[model samples]
Target chain A: MKVASIGLGLIGGSFALALQEHVLEVEIWGIDHNQAHIEAALARKIIHHKGSIDDLKNFDLIVLSIPVDAASALLPEILHQAEKECLVIDMGSTKNDVCEAVKNHVKRNQFLALHPIAGTEFSGPKAAFASLFNNAMMIVCEAEKTDENLKKKAYQILQKLKMQLHFMSPKEHDKHLAYVSHLSHVSSFMLGKTVLDLEKNEGEIFNLAGSGFESTVRLAKSNSKTWIAIFKQNKAEVLTSLKEYQQNLKEFEKLLETNQFSELENLLNSTSRIKEILAKK
Target chain B: MKVASIGLGLIGGSFALALQEHVLEVEIWGIDHNQAHIEAALARKIIHHKGSIDDLKNFDLIVLSIPVDAASALLPEILHQAEKECLVIDMGSTKNDVCEAVKNHVKRNQFLALHPIAGTEFSGPKAAFASLFNNAMMIVCEAEKTDENLKKKAYQILQKLKMQLHFMSPKEHDKHLAYVSHLSHVSSFMLGKTVLDLEKNEGEIFNLAGSGFESTVRLAKSNSKTWIAIFKQNKAEVLTSLKEYQQNLKEFEKLLETNQFSELENLLNSTSRIKEILAKK
Candidate 1:
């Protein structure tokens, strides 16, 4: 099987590496508008060859692993030109926008909207690794709109890469992801900005920052272009989650103002449930 | 030299283990209100023996590794009973209150206010480890209030344990810590609460949670009792930092609501400075 991957950055490059590592008799062709990324992907041996959108007509699979906006913009064009039996999958953080944009296309049934729930703080071709998707959840949204064979093909591919498959509506996925993933990035970025603004002395920041701060602020280093697109595409849900988070912070502030130690204790106790939720994973 | 550690839980137990690991001639005696913790510390080989506050006169050094409230409440009594030549130190989050509470004590010169910027999400005797302080920061506040010779002894001990020493005023330490450490914990706890509230299906949370969520929310599992005391002790600074964080979130929300992608991109880009700061450390 031949896989033509768009974007050829972190997610795409990593997926190409995973395919090379896990699948038998498979070749990956990389595509990206960023010439530097394509060059780096080639130099890093992230793909077997560099290809273009025109190559989509011949590949067995075409993976859209670009920014959400770029994916939404380019997907319909790829759908129009792809072969009937070819399986096109998008590995975007926000699924609803892209799914809606391509809903009425003639080749819509050939496309599968997927979100592989995995990543690290690093990005670009150099950050790609062979085991990026191992044991990670791969969400397939609006599967009813996809052809049976195409859906099966996507699932088989994910399974071969050692990913757990999940099914949910695009709307549900967007909402939940806003709370769990998108909001985390926003919170971390803002936390980084807050600390950086206060601690002008970089030496102090380096010396005084412990693991807790490092862990919480790790996502602050994520790609701005990718995150802006995510926040824009999932605006409403992200806004709602942000409001709730701010309210929680305000309540904590009020408790502190009143010196209500027990109330603060209760809040911390209530939120400690994350341990169980995360541990079960 | 002999050491008596009050509150033989995570921090105290870890310190005791470090003493055993680093200093061959030093003996550690555990003192805690909870008899079970003392037994567990002994069973875990965290300490050589068990003792009470009455034994303060016997030990060459006294380490207070309790909650901020307990440290403030017990410092005077412990100082009043300790030998003049003995060195007393605390490993609490806040330094101002502890230092002030003992400022007028007759044995105040023998007391040292230290905050070791090291910990894990886990607590209790089981969480204790000899290498907890390796490459971590040790902040010593108001060193002038400490006897010069005793301060030298404390510095020698911390230096032997391979920790970087930073000196700052208690107010500066509290202000900076509120932004770097306390604010991170609050954001993490609130994030955990927000996600848990939205994710009614525990199975979905367990399945969909990725490394991003795990790292950002790691501190949400911290001990509620210890954190509540810390929040109360550093209430003002925490409230100020929380307000700044909420403002940043609100700005991002506005950017999202208005489809100001550039603004969002710029904010995220600016916040990426955390990478440089962390990399330097």
Candidate 2:
């Protein structure tokens, strides 16, 4: 089947590479607003040929892999200009804006919102690689709004990527992603900021950083271009999540300051439940 | 060399294994207050045989690897009972209290303070491994206070484990560790508590927890016995570190609330410098 893989960054580029390695009969056409990305992706053999918005009519499927803002802004235009039978799907992190943008459009049933739960700290076409989505969760939002026949085709593509698909309403996906995914990035980035500030004089202490610190601050390296768009798209939920996280951190600070050792230990024990839950996942 | 490995938990047990693997003509005698740990460690061959605090005089080197409170409490007695030539060192996370405890002892020259920058969420004899110290930093505190010849023997042991040893005063070690190690655990545990509390109903969100979340919260699973002692022993500095961290989180929260997207993006960019520093480590 013919495919259009837009936004040749980590998520999109990886998706295209995964498709090429898994599906023998598939042809992936690349499209990106960034000329450098398109050039890099093509040189990396991430896609077969460069395509445009006008070329959307020639594909059986169109996958949006750009920043959330771009995907939300361009969805209506992509649907309006593309062929009727062309199934368009987005791999954007936030789903609400995209879902709302096309809610009343005539080709609404052709659009599906998806967030494949995978990524590295790195970005751009050069950061893409095969099996990036393998064994990861694929959260499908507003699935009921999409055409049934088109979803089956999309599901087949996801199956080839070896994703475990789960359904959620757009509202639910936005709130949940804010807490589990978005909040993690903010907390980690801020934690990195705290360390860099506090440890500037203790240059010797950097060597003391073990695997735990590395893992804890790994998301600090995520590019702001991609994240600023996500934080903007899910601003309300992110604000709420950050408020709750700050409250929790404040309480912990109070315990440490007051020398409430027992209470601090208990608070830590409550969080230990995450280990069991995460291990199950 | 005859080595008395006191407290056969993660650090000491792992030290025993490393010594067996690297140093020739070495006999490791394990000692612990816990009867079960003694049995488990002996069964796992983490120690050549089980010994007691009373056997301290029989060994050329005595390694303390118990809770900071216990290490601080037992150090004077161990030094009093041990031979004058025996080099006694405590592999405790906090240094100021332990150093203060034994500062005026006649056997002070035989005591050295170290904080090996290595560990996992898991603990006990089973957690011990031969290469746990490989390429990891060993923070040697109050080296000037210890006898020069004994410090060299200890350095020789560290070198055999392939450790990059750096010397610091107890004050420097405590304050630096508060930021570099202790504070990371606090941020991680609190992040876990926040997620566990907020995402209780959003069971589906767990599926979306990628490697980033796992890394940030991995320290939450660390046992309280060890961490509680660490937080207690280093209470003042831990409290100070927690205050700075809380301030940073609050500033980030304010930016999110005020919709200062550009400033938030800048903060994240500033934190990204950690990536280069960590890569070098």
Candidate 3:
């Protein structure tokens, strides 16, 4: 089988590597607009060859692993040109926009909207790892719109990659992702902003940053281009989460102002439920 | 030398372990109001023996690794009864209140206020590790209030543990820590709250929680009691930082509302400087 992956950066590059490692007799082809990323992916041996859309006719599958906004804009064209039996899957962060945009495409049944809920803060081809998706959840959205054989193939691919699969609608995926994924990036970015703005003395921040601060602010290093696209794609849900988050902050501020140590402690205790939630997962 | 560490939980248990590993021929004693903690510490072999305040008189060094409020209330009494040359030090998250409470004590010169900028979200004796302080910063505040020889001994001990030493005034340390440490806990706790509120469907959040959310919300699992004391001790500084963070969020929200993607992009881009700042450390 030949697998062609577009936008061969972190997610795509990792997918290409996973295919190479796990699948027998699989040849991986890569497509990326960024010349540097393509070269990096090639040098890193993440792909067997670099391919163009013109080569889409020869591949068994094409995976779109770009930003959501870019994926939404490009999916129709890619779907229009791909062969009827070819499987096209996207590993974009947001799904509803892409699904809506390609709903009417002639080859829409060939496309599967998937979000492999796995990533590191680092990006680019160099950040790809073979075990990046191990034991991670992969959410497949709008599966009803996809062809049965393609869905089976996609599930087999994810299973061989050692990912647990879950299914949901594109609308549900977007809302939940805004809370769990997109909001985290914003919170981290804002935290970095808050700390940077308050501490004019850079030396102090560097000197005093412990593992807690490092872990909490780790996602602040995420690429702005990708995050902006995610935020824009999931704007309404993101906005709602942001409002609640800001309100939580304000409530915490009021507690601090009144020296309500008990209330503050109670509020913090409520969030400790994440430990149980995370532990179960 | 005999070392007694009060409050044998996370910081104290780790410090006792560090003493066993680093300080040659030292006898370590554990003290905690929680009988279970004391029993757990002994069972885990985190300390050489269990003791009470009666054993405090026999130790060459006495370490206070309790919550800030408890430390503030206990330090003066501990100082009043400690030997003339006994080195008393604390490992609280906040420094100002504890430093001030012991400022005019008769044994002020024998007391040292230290905040080791190291910890994980997990706590208790089981969480103790021998190399917890390795390559981490130990901030010593108000060094002038400490006896020269005692301060030297404290520095020597911390150095023996392989921690880098940073000296700052208590006020400066509290202000800086509010940004780097305290604010991170609050941000993480609130991020957890926001996600937990929105992710009412358990399976969705479990499936969708990528590394981004996990990293950003990791600190929310920190001990509530310890953080409440920190928030109370550094209330003013925390409030200031919280307000600034709220303002930044509001600005970002306005940008989203106005479809000002460029401004939002710039905001995220500017905050990415934290990567460099953290990288330097």
Candidate 4:
């Protein structure tokens, strides 16, 4: 199968590598706005050739791996330019805006809105690796909207990459991701901001930074172009999640203020149930 | 030199294992408030024997590995009970309260306040492992308060464990830790609470849990006894950090509400500096 991977950053680049590793016959074409990313991905052999949306008609599969805003804008046009049998898939973090934008389009069936639940605190084609999707989830939102044959083909290719398929609606994907993915980024960013803002002598004091602080704030390192688009697209659900998170933080502070050690322990114990929930999964 | 590890949980048990691995002849006498923990550590050979504060006088080194509250409550008595040559060291997360409690004691010079900046979300003897302290930071607070000879011995032992030693005052340690260690736990716990509380069908929705969310919320699994004591002991600084964090979240919320994508991107870009800070360390 011939494939064109858009964006050429962490997710897109890694997808290209993983796809190439899993299926030897699969040919990946690189499409990225950044010339450096295109050059790096090409140098790394992450793709067979550099291509534009105009050239997408030559491929059987086109993966949209760009930022949500860019992907949302390009999806309809890409679908319009694609062969009727072409399977167009998205690997964006948020789903609502992009999915809704192309929902009523004439060639909508050619595009499958999907998110591969895998990444690291790094970016660029240089950050790409072959096993990024190994043992991770590939969330397919609005799968019913795609052609059955195309969905099956996409599933088989993802299965080859060792990803667990999770089905959800575009609405469900946006809501759950706001709580699960987007909110965590918000939490991590604020954590990094809080520490950096509080410490004026960042270089000296960062030596005092431990693994817990580092892990909790790691998502704060995410690129602005990608994440800013996600935050804007999933605005409402993200707002709700933040409010609930702030309320919890306020309550925790109150417990400390009142010297309610017992209550604080109970709260912490309740929260610790996340360990079991996470472990079981 | 003989060592008594006073808590058979993650930190204490791991400390014993790391010490035993580094120094084949070092004897670790285990002490714990939980009889089960003592038995478990003994069976695992994490300790040479199950001992107590009463047995501390017989050892050349007394390692206080208990929770902050228990360690805070016991430090004065442990120092008083310890032999003059026995150096008492603490591995508690927070230090100011414990240090202040014994500042006026006659045997204060024998006690050195220290924190190993290492741990997992898991707890107990089974979770303990050798090399846990390897390539990790060990903060020795108020080292000047301890006898110079005892401090040297402690430094040599930590060096054997392959840890980097950082010296700071008890006040500085507590304040800095409030921003670095303690605040991150609060962030993780509140994030877990926010998600758990909002999701009614948590077990079903948790299937959506990704690595990003899991990593950000991992500290929520920390044992309650250890963290409650930390929050209570360092209440003021934790509260200050929480307030600052909440303020940042509110500003971020407003940015999203007003469609101020540029400002949001700038904030995220600035916070991305955490990547550089963490990488250097």
Ranking by lDDT: 1, 4, 3, 2
lDDT of 3 at B244: 85
The interface root-mean-square deviation of each model, in the order shown, is: 1.1, 1.4, 1.1, 1.0
By DockQ thresholds, what CAPRI class is model 1? high
Error of 1 at B74 (Å): 0.4
Which tens-of-lDDT digit does each residue in A9-91 have in candidate 4? 99999999988889869887888878999899989999888888677777899988998999999988898888988999989
> Which stretches of candidate 2 lie above 4 Å from their native place?
A202-204
Candidate 1: tens digits of C-alpha lDDT, residues B77-195: 99888887899999999998999898888889999999999999988888999999987889999988889999999988898899888899999888889988999999999998888
For every model in order, the fraction of real contacts preserved is 0.87, 0.72, 0.89, 0.84
What is the Cα-based lDDT of residue B19 in candidate 3? Answer: 87
Q: What clash count does candidate 3 reach?
A: 0
Q: What is candidate 4's CA lDDT for residue A87?
A: 93
Instruction: Give the better candidate number (2 or 4) by DockQ.
Output: 4
- lDDT of every model, 2 decimals: 0.88, 0.87, 0.87, 0.87
- The list of candidate 4 runs beyond 4 A from truth reads A201-203
Model 2 alpha-carbon miss at residue B87, Å: 0.6
- TM-scores of all candidate predictions against the true structure: 0.97, 0.97, 0.97, 0.96
> Could you give the CAPRI-style class of model 2?
medium
DockQ of candidate 2 is 0.74
- Separate DockQ for every predicted complex: 0.83, 0.74, 0.83, 0.82
Question: Residue pairs in steric clash, candidate 3?
Answer: none
**Model 3 global lDDT (CA atoms, 0 to 1):** 0.87
